[model samples]
Target chain A: MATNQQRDTNLSPDEARALRFDVEEFNTEYARILDAQDIDAWPDFFTTDGFYRITGRENYDAGLTIGLVWCDGRPMMQDRAAAVKTTMVHAPRYLRHYNSNVRVTGVDGDGTIHSESNYLVVETLMEEETRIFQAGLYIDQFVREDGGMLLKSRDCIYDSLLIPNDMVYPV
Target chain B: MPDTPFIDDGSNLPLSELRWPDDDLTRIPDWIYTSDEVFQRERERIFFGESWCFVALEAEIPDPGSFKRSYVGDVPVIVSRDQDGEVHVFENRCAHRGVEFCRDLRGKAENFTCPYHQWMYDLSGKLMAVPFRRGDRGEGGMPKDFKLEDHNPKKLNVTIRHGVVFASFSETVESLEDYLGPDNLEQFDVVFKGRKLKILGFYKNRLQGNWKLYHENLKDPYHATLLHVYLATFRLMVAGQKSAMICDESGRHSTMASAKDDDIEITEETASQMKSAFREGMELSDPEFLNYVQEFDSPWTVTMQIIWPNLIVQRELNTLGIRHIVPRGPNALDMYWTMFGYDDDTPEMDKHRLKQANLMGPSGYLGVDDNEAIKFLQDGFKHSQDGEGIVKLEPEKEGSTQTLISEASVRALYRHYREVMDI
Candidate 1:
């Protein structure tokens, strides 16, 4: 009889380890995509029906508030990417994200892998020197899919209480 | 040192002539934003004067002896429930030396003890105990004539309606109903509904802009569709919806409401095109996006209530929220947004709310854009001697119902603002 873990269709242990590496690669690629200002490629990392939200830990822990950016489906995410890229006018700056310490926290009975990682983003603006923009941990949930893994949800909990400047793009 | 040429005092500069055209408010006097004197006067006349500020909801302090501490303008206040089940609000300062009496954000406390001298006050704002009061030898302690009754913190006028709590510094301020106005009162009823509330969470962010700018942002509906395109792309709000900008008789409170499209007819050709281009009809990985269950009594998809001075109650689709503005300085304001769902919401609905919660908060796709925009406005004002941004979007109309792309409500806000400031 296939046990719950065996019955599940997640990648094998070795494959899962490799999948983690794949996720790291994906995270780096995602950051690069944002840095490149190629918003169209940003939404491609998630599943079609994935969830993406940017919320402060204060609201998240209190369970009393919503986030600034909430995208439940891929279309919504795509729509946000399109809108911010084309319509919004913001001060020009360059953001460099460093995502590390990727660890899979748990694997649910349904083969959903819960993971977390620490990240720091440094932003340099025109006529200003580089500064630490934000540092936080990314709490994410992933599901196995054909050919690769798909992100089901991503929650970024920033450690920096004060945001130096406005958050215009995805972290 | 004899007859110095008579220099003219600037008082004759014709201040009214300096005012921008009655229809336009874009070129506001630099004195409005940068004057320390004006800010101090505003603090006295508005924040500490006649205005009903929303303090806390009944749900926050439910049981007797439960208490929550918040600020009314800049004054720290304690909202507590007494043994008799009545709620009372008092300044959170010890009357003796004006030390902060309550330190906890929220808790069940029988009485608040001042750490400075150990003076105690009950939840009812009555002096309860004072340490070493009766001198052992009847010599050294609180003055023999010191009376406990005289040391109670100042109590403000308070009123509760539909589970929301409001307090005012001025005794002569209008009643809650009068303050909320008729149109906004009806909208409040729709969201609050007298039901027991469940607090979902709280989000806090500091906007580097004047507090007035935040109020104007909420009142100005023109930016909604353009700034928050997530609303349009997801069909949460469309350009063609029937929308209204409503204000109270006093013009202090405002409501921006819009109904979603119930009769959206999609032609087969368009449907096919949308499906192919964006995969519109595909099932969301999380089904919550497709869930638009109307739990509130209102027909509108979103109702953003801008209570005068510094409170906003937002009922957006499934997410219910309250935003409180705390001003740190003339240029910086802290925003505390609390999102909520009713206690009776089912697990599915709760999940739906949590999923939809992405629409608000500091990181919210819509909210972040607003924060960025507010900062941009502040930054723009810093370099320019002109302190005010033009808000003359729709000049012809008054008393709400302007075009979707106009700043009429912002004008209304400033109109009431000038009344309070008496500028």
Candidate 2:
């Protein structure tokens, strides 16, 4: 027996409109935190067991298990934030994320929502020109928590073959 | 009696503007890492000469039409399995105008047509047809007797061993076995194991340094003990362990292997007291990543093998991978890492590999540091009037040695590099 996920189509126009507004607000906050390099507060954006990964679309479509940064749970992400900040010393840079073309693709019977949006991150070092750091799609799964949208999973599927110098920040 | 077998004696100098530092393999002239003259010569002699460059794995293209984009030096090539289940690798250039025909990194394609002139070629790179061959009005096409058989993209001699693919530009290049030698072959086959491979993912990045620096890094196990803290922080590798740094007769290919001591238990107290890269009170929240499931019978839990100029086969406690190096210029090079696991891996085993993958890649605890060290070397020598690097650790011994605290393998790399480069 097939689940009704494919053919539900039961989202009313008004409900879909409201969900889109909430998703837009959620993404705005997401970009603000990342661009500000508020890495310490990253955990608050996700659930206790959220999954975050940054990989190439090639690997994502092939269902490969590896990523540039593969965080299976909240602890892994927390560890990364802690280690890179305290232990690792690398050239500092600034990043700004521009997310657009957002689309809320689906909503489960539960409060879970599926979404995708086009994203391009610009990276600027001390003296270098602001270059296109990474361009990709954000494949996301979100749910309501404390009356605000919280990410359950965020798969950053980048398009380029080569990552410049260092992907220091979470793109 | 002179203690050092080779030394910078500073005598009888026939310095024709580009001589290396004395006769010692340890003292490398800064010029080799900085000269445009040397970089140009290397492209032809080292890359196109009698060297078997790692192109792709047999498992990368699993189906008849499957393909992967790869590099042989700076030249782009398409590694595709043809309809009859035979693997063929050909230059991505179109014979018509020398333009790159295969644009996408990879995909299934029956035939490719040049976008410039629409000259069609089959999967085997044979020229099949040209659009408007006789012209729309039978007036402006090729000559009446033009032969379509004359044109094809350059094809290379490909050798597939244990699911690893090596290609050579020279048709007369020795067999893969002859090139790798018995010692290197045994080490190379240890990881390949004739088991089916499943490509897990890739991590691609560039280093702001010479491409050969990447090769030397793998050959020099001296740095692994000093540079990477995560190795010892997790008790994966500790100095003075049972290890071997083995090289082939040519000294171009080498393997640095270190066996794990399963009996040792790592704690904050034991770590801080040790003089190694171990840190006190620095333990992983998820220690499961450090577990080395003895999937192989080799004494070593970690083995980093360098197959001459292009490839690195790594088995760091069951997290297997092959990193391909593409030289962009004298100052920069791109690295493409293909991480994999056995096709028959259990879910538990797969997670183990993925968790440990944090040990490598761009943000990898150990991997990024390797990139930084090489970049520092390149920058450190950019404007130096006279500078040379000392690889004289465990001096006088240039071939395979048992000690982990040795730069003997770095000497091995330069020995073969000089012979091929005739510098």
Docking class of 2: acceptable
Q: For candidate 1, what is the lDDT?
A: 0.72
Worst 10 residues of 2 chain A by lDDT: A1-10
Q: What is the lDDT of residue B238 in candidate 1?
A: 50
The fnat scores of all predictions, in order, read 0.38, 0.41
Compute each candidate's TM-score over C-alphas.
0.78, 0.89
**lDDT by residue for model 2 (A39-104), tens:** 888867789889888888778776787988888777777777765664344667788989987767
* Model 1 chain A worst lDDT window (10 residues): A1-10
List TM-scores of chain B, every candidate: 0.87, 0.92
TM-score (C-alpha) between model 2 and the true structure:
0.89
Which whole-number lDDT from 0 to 100 does residue B214 have in model 1? Answer: 82
Compared with the true structure, what per-residue lDDT tens digits does model 2 show for residues B233-330? Answer: 55566666688998998889998899888556665554564554666467555556678898885888889998888999988887899999999867
Query: Model 1, range B42-124, lDDT digits (tens) per residue?
Result: 77788778888888888888899999888788778999999999989999999889899698777798888999988889898
What's the DockQ for every one of the candidates?
A: 0.24, 0.33
